[model samples]
Target: MRFYRQFRAYLVRRKVWEVTAYLFFGILTTLVNVLIFSVAFRLLELPWPTSNSLSWLVSVIFAFFTNKLWVFHSGASGTRSTLWTLLKFMLVRILSYGLDMLTMWLIIDAMHGNELIAKLITQVLVVAVNYIFSKLFVFADSNSG
Candidate 1:
């Protein structure tokens, strides 16, 4: 009960509505990723994994900038710190992306479902995983990069 009060105060003090807004931006970014990958893979005859990675790389840049400026409103860090943040973001995402691929591979290749359908399911899960890590880990502040 006491801990709950402290948590509520933290949220209120920090204007946690801003977090919600950031998450909304994340949702849009996720849509952008899916759209890019789906179009490139399905319509443009690009390979599935290739399209997925390329889309993620592009969207990560978008997500990073928005998160730095709007979500956390983090002050400018030196180049090393900025690079570290991006590195951490990529490292955190690697496992989640791998899991997404495994799931899609299992669903589409093993189970013989549609690849596009499997991608849709994986996209939803990956977006949530990324959002949590991006907020709590990648963008976390520290004296050391």
Candidate 2:
């Protein structure tokens, strides 16, 4: 029990806790994206692009709230501040979404590769990039400025 408490305390250290929380939320976000995309693309016969966009929308919304509240602990300060933060988050995500679309297009459309495989690859890339952006830009401490 003592060792377990120490381990828990170690995990709760700032960077460690942030990363662990981000990873947990990130995985949930990925699952949300993949499930929506799979259902739309494979089950409903939607085009890959449309399905991907829809999935991105849902997952981004999920990610923003989870990332803000749990991962970074960047709780809303005021309406304007929260809106600004959300705007920045969306802009960064749009950049990553472009990357996602381009990679997916190249793999599934141009290279004639598997859509699901391409999506999985894209998720890994997107998640890494999003973490960087969110940590450095979107959710950085407001008082740091």
Candidate 3:
């Protein structure tokens, strides 16, 4: 009971609910990506690489909206603010995706680590980077105007 209370208090104090929401929506976004990939590649007979790229594009757009509205509750109004936020979000995601790929390469190829373990570790790092980027840079300048 004491631990639970302490954990709850910490969550509230640190606004961890935003992280929780982000994760939930992130999972949904991933599922959407996978589904699109499967449909495009397996069902529609599209090339695998093309399907993968399309899925990634769709998922990133979905993630941006969900993270902005549901997770961060960004108050930056106006069309310019929205477009600027989106550009920043895309830039940060691109950087983090590169970091994730590099982490995987270092862990798996250079270190001879197991593929699944390397991917899991890379994902953790990616999530931390993404959260920090989203919070501190991407959605940080909302003026509610």
For each candidate, how many residue pairs have backbone atoms clashing (under 3 Å)?
A: 0, 0, 0
Give one digit per residue, the lDDT tens place, for model 3 in 11-122: 6678676777678887787677668767896788886446656765787888898988877888867999889889999999888767766775687578977644654565
**Poorest stretch of ten by lDDT in candidate 2:** 136-145
Candidate 1 segments whose C-alpha is farther than 4 A from its true place? 1-15, 142-145
Task: Kindly list the per-residue Cα lDDT of model 1 for residues 49-85, writing each as its tens digit.
Answer: 7887877777777777877776666554899878888
Better of 2 and 3 by TM-score: 2
Q: Could you tell me how far off, in angstroms, the CA of residue 48 lies in candidate 2 after the best superposition?
A: 0.4
Clashing pairs in 3: none
TM-score of each: 0.76, 0.90, 0.66
lDDT of each: 0.75, 0.90, 0.74
Candidate 2 yields a Cα-based lDDT of 0.90
Which predicted model would earn the best lDDT?
Answer: 2
Error of 1 at 102 (Å): 1.3
- Could you say which candidate leads in TM-score? 2
Deviation (Å) of 89 in candidate 1: 1.0
